[model samples]
Target: MIEGPYFVLVVLGALWCGVAAGVFVAFSTLVMRGLGALPAARGIAAMNSINVAAMTPAFMVVFMGAALLCAVIAVVTFVLWPEPGTVELLVGCVLYLAGSFGVTVVANIPRNDALAKLAGDEDSERSAAYWRRYLSEWTLWNHVRGGAALAASAAFVLSLT
Candidate 1:
């Protein structure tokens, strides 16, 4: 069984993953919905502002820190434990790294970037069209990210038990 500092790391990592998951959940549950209900250009503008504002140091410390911790947990678990014991940790690690972090980098960030470049005009038909696409596409990927985070959190916790 995991003990000492490694155990603490595992728990902290899971907690961070859980926190990250909660942020995504909030976005999926209400934030996006609220934005979507606004006029398209307004919605898009709001989202662009949110995307820009979300890059604060506090958010990155949790988001990227969770990814880092997951990597560390996977490596340490693999080295310290046998097959079955390490399995969940590795699974959690992969989900966080590839599913959560990768999707954010590969899919969501690009979408946010594209949205940022859009002109913020409430009456612009083009803005409306872009908002339609962004709302659907971005939210879909966010669900993936949130689900992966929750699953990774569960996996890490399971590994400890």
Candidate 2:
């Protein structure tokens, strides 16, 4: 059975993944929907505000810390090959690193960066068009990341058992 600092890390990783999953799920299920219901300009403005708020130290520590932990776990898992829960631990690492963290870097952040460039003027056709597409695309990616984090958390829990 896994023990010592390694075991503690895994437990923490599981909790972190669960927290990340909950945040993503909130955006996918409720936050985005509520924002989308607003006028296009208002929705864009609100999302921009949310995006800025998300960068605060509290959220970043959890989100980025989870990614860092996953990377460390993956490397350690490789070095300590054939240990108990190896497969499950590796699965959790990959799910969070690639599916959640990687997707955020590749898919969501770019879109957010683009959205940030917009003036969010109510009369601007360009902003309105982008906002419509952003609502659907961003939320779709959010759903994927949320599922991945939840699955990672489950995998980590399985490793403990």
Candidate 3:
């Protein structure tokens, strides 16, 4: 049974993961679709604005704080091997760190960076082409990260049981 500081940490981690999941799921479900429905230039501009806004301190704290907690939990889980909830804790950490955070860094951010560099001219063939690809690819990866974050939250909750 999880207890003491460890239990508290896991609970915090669960909450953070759920929050991250909610944000990602919003983008995956409604946000991206709404942006895609706009003109190519408009979509590009909106996404770029969103990308910039996402870097704000509030969002970064939650997103990166969850990652930090996951890392700490993973190391502690290993150090205290054979403990109850070890497997669940480890699963939760890996799912969040790799599936959610890792994909964001590896797959999504690069696409956002590329999109940010575009001129966003409605008549530009290049902007339109990239926008089409970005809409599909970015949203696909968003779905992946969102699912991972939710799964990680569930695993953390199970650790307490």
Candidate 3 on 89-143: residue-level lDDT in tens? 9999999999999999999999999999895465588999999999999999999
Off by over 4 Å in 2: 120-122
Per-residue accuracy of model 2 over 1-161 as CA lDDT, tens digit each: 78899998899999999999999998899999999999889988888899999989999998999999999888888988899898999999999999999999999999999998985464599899999999999999999999999999999999989
Per-residue lDDT for 1-161 in model 1, tens only? 77889889989988999999999989988999999999887888788888878889999998999999998888898787784547888889999999999999999999898887785464678778888898899999999999999999999899888
TM-score of candidate 3 to 2 decimals: 0.96
Steric clash pairs (candidate 2): none
C-alpha-based local distance difference test score of model 1 = 0.89
**lDDT for each candidate structure:** 0.89, 0.92, 0.93
Query: After superposition, which runs of candidate 1 have C-alpha atoms over 4 Å from their true positions?
Result: 120-122
Between candidates 1 and 2, the one scoring higher on TM-score is 2
